[model samples]
Target: MVAQQHGRRGAAFAAVTMAGAVAGVVATTGCSGEVGATADDRPAGGPRVVREAADVLLASGSSKARTSMEMAAGGTRVTIRGEGGYNFAERIGRLKVVLPRDPAGASEHRPITELVAPAALYMKNRGAGVPADKWVRVDATTLEDGNLVTGGATDPLAAAELLRAARNVTFVGSQDLAGTRVWHYRGVTDIGEAAKVASPFARGALNAAAKGFAKDVVPFDAYLDDEGRLRKVRHRFSYLNQGRTVDVASTTLLYAFGSAVSVQLPPAADIFAGKIGT
Candidate 1:
């Protein structure tokens, strides 16, 4: 799909879904390869380390994610920053997003909160020059209907699924991210597996990842902390956005494994049923 030019800055969604927002989390956002792997490097450890981590974290019931997506092309820049958590077992998530400002860069720090529950998607307080009033409620399967989700929407954890399905993984090195020592591994994903979790909104991101892969494998990185918990991930790819192939880099960091994450749809009275469009 062609990228939509909005306001002043380029348009981009984020990595994590807000109730139902599909974002690779590129521009205003959110890389790489390797040589002779090394003694501590595991060329095949990518899948095992990442997959096992996904299994542990997802099964742990809850997690907190901090994501960033950034893309720069055609003399424009777009970015999305979000912080929140999710409960996979409950099929629920919440995110507070700081959207890119208008072209003129005039905007307040109006962070929108997105709540995703089993039955519906709710977006609270959007639109410029508008006051806080109600949350926009949408059907679970149609997250983009109100433009609240902007582009199409998909499950944010699809990235984890992508990693779980990675192959030809190689160990990069060990580093510290946010004070946690981590072992980094890079691997390629199978398109067939990616397609399983992909939605219209995520297709471009996944396809770009595939195109960026070596041997039909788009490389993504997974970081395992000292405790063997998945702490961070980074994905790179190029997408046909707005008729141009724009580069996208996204990062998702998961923490607080097993923490309580209970996201609920706001009360019905707080839901806005009025028409909202771009």
Candidate 2:
């Protein structure tokens, strides 16, 4: 199935999904008093507790991630199968995408890789006219000038923002996921509220990508490790697709903590920094 390919926003989701599996995100600054994780002095559940654990996890070194997203009701089944990891302290990461063969045609599947930093984003086999074995370098500053997500939010880092804006956090029961013990938490969030909060990666650099997403509260279930880091996340939500609400169910699994994730800028001679359309 053909997916509504979002541009920079898609990249942003890729990053945050990686982050959710890797590091996590900053705290919710706007609703500081209203939303915050519990201090070590007190134990609490909900958004605050989950946020703190997420923050700790996100701040850690590196992690291995497995992510998959599907649009409910015959939507496209998204797969991100590879060794994706990041270094939150350094603000850099890489993703090796091993896509499955297209069901419509007997085409070979090629793995695509990406290296993302605070300043630029690099990708392989992204768009037409891109040179072979070359990484497309797009300035993070100019990404929002174009239609990254048609009739959607521009914030490339929407996932981080969405996590920060999550509310009504409550502690659910515990369970074993992927052979790991985890604490489950549930919450609702106004995905767009992150636009108001400042982030080194997001902030003013985004448009309202959340506009097309269904305004009704979207709920998510997050599994946290003993260290309070997010180990797995599953959410069922819908966003407006071509003026119609399309349900999207996504699951992200994170493991291999403290793995070495080193990302460096590619050779300038082999880079393509231009308008990217995929």
Put down candidate 1 lDDT per residue, 1-278, tens digits, no spaces: 11122221133332212212223452211122223436765434455667666556556688887766655633665666677888867656787767666545675446777775533456666543223777765443232111222322223455565665677777777765655556788777765466455434434444443433233345677877766667777766444434555555666777767877878767777766554433
Per-residue lDDT tens digits of candidate 2, residues 1-278? 01123354344333222221111121112211112234552245546656554356557767766555443323334333444776665666676655444545476445657665644556677555566777766554444322122111111123334466678887666666666666777887654564455364654333343443455456777767677777766655555433556555555566788988777778877776554443
Q: lDDT at 126 for candidate 2?
A: 54
lDDT value, candidate 2, whole model: 0.51
lDDT by candidate, in order shown: 0.54, 0.51
**Stretch of 10 with least lDDT, candidate 2:** 147-156
Candidate 1: global Cα-lDDT? Answer: 0.54
TM-scores for all candidates?
0.67, 0.69
Highest-scoring model, lDDT: 1
Q: Which stretches of candidate 1 lie over 4 Å from their true place?
A: 1-45, 116-121, 128-131, 137-156, 197-217, 267-270
